[model samples]
Target: MFKYIKNDLPASIVVFFVALPLCLGIALASGAPLFSGLIAGIVGGIMVGALSGSQIGVSGPAAGLAAIVLAAIATLGYENFLVAVVLGGAIQLLFGILRLGIIGYYFPSSVIKGMLTGIGIIIILKQIPHFFGYDPDPEGDFAFFQVDGKNTFSEILETVNNISPGATLIALIGLGILLLWSNVLSKKGKFFQLVQGPLVAVVIGILFYVFTKNNETLAISADHLVNVPVPEDASSFLAQFSFPNFAAITNPAVWLTAFTIALVASLETLLCVEATDKLDPEKRVTPTNRELLAQGTGNIVSGLIGGIPITQVIVRSSANIQSGGKTKASAIIHGFFLLISVMLIPRLLNMIPLSVLAAILFIVGYKLAKPKLFKTMYQLGWKQFLPFITTVLVIVFKDLLWGIGIGLAVGIAVILIKSYQNSHFLHIEGEDVDDGKIKMTLAEEVTFFNKGAILKELDKLPENSYLELDVTKTRYLDNDIIEILEDFSTKAKNKNINIKLISERGIVENPPSYIEFFKLRPKTSV
Candidate 1:
C-alpha cells in the first residue's frame, strides 16, 4: 500500500483540497452541524479507505443525500437521525453479507459511461459561478435545481452580474498555473511532478489573498474563501462531536429513514465503484462486497461520532485518480490531512480561495467528458448511443439516480425492440413452386418477447408449402412461444403446409404436442 507513497502523497493533498469544501458544504446543505461533514470526510477517508477493496475510490459525505438528510433531521431531530445512520450502516453490512453487490454489475456500460460524462459536464457548469465568486449554492450541490432556488443556468446568468474582479483574476492565474504545471512543468522535472499543480495554485491563491487584503479592487472577500470552523480550545473542539440517541431506534420513522439511507448509499457506492474502476489507469476491478462492508463500517463509525452519511464519492475519487493516485494510501492519508488541518491549520486552510479550487475542478471535469468521447459513443451506433446520450442529458437536467433510471429504461426498451425484430430468420428455398419450401431458424434464446415476430412470420407461410422449423441453435425456449408454435401447427394443417421440426433431440414431422415434446427435453442447449 505504501509502495507508491511518493505518488500517493501528492494525490492525497489534491484530494484533501477537493474533499474539504465538499464535506463542509454538504453538511451545511443537509442542515447538520458543519463539523459533522468533516467528521464524515475523516472517517470515510481513513476507515473506509483502509477497509475498501478499491484502490482509487474516496468515500465521504455525499451531496446526493443532503436533501434526504435534511428532511430526516427535521422529522426525527439530529440525535435521532444519527440512530438512523447507524441502522443504515447495519443494513449495508447485511447487504454485503448477502452478496448483493452483484446489483452494480447489472447496469449497462453505456449508462455508466454516460454517468461519468454527465457528471463532468455538471462539474464544469456548476463551478463556473464559484469561479466568478458568485457562490449562492454549496460546492457539492450537483442537482439541476439547486437548494438556492436557482437552477444551473439561472445561477450562471446571475453570476454575470455579480462577478468579483478579485476572484476572477485569481481564478485565471490559478487555471493558468494548473495548465502549465500539468502540461509543461511536470514533464520537465520530477520535483514538479511531486509537488502537484493544484497545491501550487492553492498556495499562490492564498498568498494573493493575503497580499491584497487592503486593496479594494483586488482583495478576495472571506465569502469567496474556504470556511472551516475554528475552535477556541481542545474542550470546545471535543464539544463539537455529538453522540447518537440510541433510544430513538424504536421510532418507526427512524427505521424507514435507515432503510432509505442504506438503499441509496449502497446504490451510490456501487455506481461510484463501477465509475472509479473505469477511470483507473490500471483498470483494476474492485470487489463490490468488500466495498459495501467497508462503507458500512465507515457509516456506523461516523454516526457514532456525529457525522453525516457516507458513500463512495465520484468527484473526490476522480480527483484522486487524475492526480496520479496508485493505491488506497492516498485516500487514507487525505483523511489524516482533514483531521490535522481541521484541528490545527484551519485558519490557514480558510485562506485558500474557492475560485482557485474551482479552477482545479475545471480541469478534472474536462478530462472526464472529453469531446472525443461523444463522437466515439455516437460512432458505436444508436443501440449504445441512445442510452449514453439519454443518461447524459437527464443527469444534467435532473439528478444522478433519475438519469440512470431513465437511461436504463430506455436501454431495456431498445433491447426488447431489437429482440422482437431478430427473433428468427426466414429463408425461401423455392418460393415460385406450387409446393414452396421455407426454413425458419430460431435465435439462440427464444423468449416471450420473440412471440410477435415468430407469429407474424408463421402467418405469412404460403398455402401448400413445406415449412422447416429449425431449433438446433436455440436454448431456453419460452413456454409462451411453444404454445404459439402448437397453434401454428394446427393452422398449417388446414393450409396444407407440411411442417418439419428440427432440434438437437431429433427431427420430427410436426411434433404431435409442442409443449409435451419440449417438456421431455432440456430447456437449454446441451
Candidate 2:
C-alpha cells in the first residue's frame, strides 16, 4: 500500500480538499448536524477505504442520499435515523455475502460512459455558481433541482448578478495557477509533480484571503469560504458525536428507512465502482461484493458515532484519479486529513476559498465530458451513441440514478430493436419466382424478444410452400417461441405448406409435437 506513497500522499491531499466541503454540505443538505458529515467522511475514508477492494475509489457522505436522509431524519428523528443507517450497513453486508456485486457488471458500457460524461457536465455546470462566489446552495448538490429554490441555469444567472469581485478574482488566479502547475510546471520536474496543482491553488487561495482581509473589493467573505466546525475545547468537541437509539430497531418505519438507504447506497456505490474502474489509468477491476462489505461496515461505524449514510462517490474518486492517486492509501490518508484538520487547524481551513475548489472541480468536469468524446460516441453509431447521449442528457436534466435508469431503458429498447431485426434469416433456395421453397434459420439464444420477427417471417410464407425451420445453431430457445412454432404448424396444414424441423438431434418431417421433441433432447442440444 505504501509502494506509491509519493503519489498517494499528494493525491490524498487533493481528495482531502475535495471531500471536506462535500462532507459539510451534504450534512447540511440532509438536515443533519454539520459534524456528522465530517464523521461520515472520516469513517468512509479510513474504514471503507481500508476494507474496499478499489484502488482509486473514495467513499464519503453522498449528495445523492441527502434527500432521503433528510426525509428519514424528519420522520424517524436523528437518533432513530442512526439506527436505520446501522441497519442499512448490515443489509449491505448481506448483499456482499450474497455476491450481488455482479449487478455492477450488468450495466451496459455505453450507459456507464454516459453516466461519467453526464456527471462531468453537471459538475461543471453546478460549480460555475460557486466559482463566481454565489453559493446559496450547499456544496455537492448535483441534482438539477437544487435544495436551494433555483435550478442549475437559474443559479448560473444568479451568479452573474451577485458576483463577488474578491471571490471571483481569487478564483481566476487559482484557476490560472492550476493550469500553469498542471500544464507547465508539473512537466518541468519531479518536485512540481510531487506538489499537486490543487494543493497549490488552495494554499494561494488561503493566502489571498489572509492578505486581503480588510480590502473592500478583494476580500472574500465567510459565506464564500470553507467552513469546518471549530471546537472550543475537548469536551465540546466530544459533544458533537451522537449515538443511535437501538430501541427503535423494532419499528417498521426504521426498517423501511434502513432498506431504502441500503438499496440506494449500494446502487450508487456499485455505479461509482463501475465508473471509477473505467477512470483508472491502470484499469484495475474493483471487487463489488467486497466494496459492499466495506461500505456496510463504514456506515455502521458512522451511524454509531452520529453520521450521515456513506457511499463510494464518483466525484471524489474521479478527483483522486485525476490527481494521480495510485492506491487505497490515498483514500485512507484523506480520512486522516479530515480527522486531523477538524481536530487541530479548522481555523486555518476556514480561510480557504470555495471558488478555488470549484476551479479544481471545473477541470475534473471538463476531463469527464470532453467534446471529443461526443464525436467518438457518435462515430460508434446510434446503437452505442444513443444510450451514451441519453444518459448524459438525462443525468444533466435529472439526478444520477434517474439518468442511469432512463438511459438503461433506452439501451434495452435499442437491444430489442436489434434483436427483432436479427432474429432470423430467410433464403429462397433454387429461386424460380413463385416456386415457394424457403429455409428459415433461427438465431442463437432465441428469446421471447424475437417472437414478433419469427411470427412475421412465418406469416410471409406463400401457399403450398415447403418451409425448413432450422434450430441447429440455437441455444436456450424460449418456450414462447416454441409455442409460436407449434401454432404455425396448424396454419401450415391449412395453407398447404410442408414444414420440416431441423435440430442437432435429427430432422423431423412436420413434427406433430415440437414441445415433446425439445423435451426429449438434452438441455445442451436445445
122-175, model 2: which lDDT tens digit per residue? Answer: 999988988998988888778898765679998898889999998989899989
Clashing pairs in 1: none
Candidates' C-alpha lDDT: 0.88, 0.88
Provide backbone clash counts, one per model.
0, 0
Model 1, span 330-375: residue lDDT tens: 9999999999999999899999999999999999999889999999
In model 2, state the lDDT of residue 198.
92
Q: Give all TM-scores, in the order shown.
A: 0.81, 0.81
Q: Which stretches of candidate 2 lie over 4 Å from their true place?
A: 423-526
Model 1 CA lDDT for position 434: 50
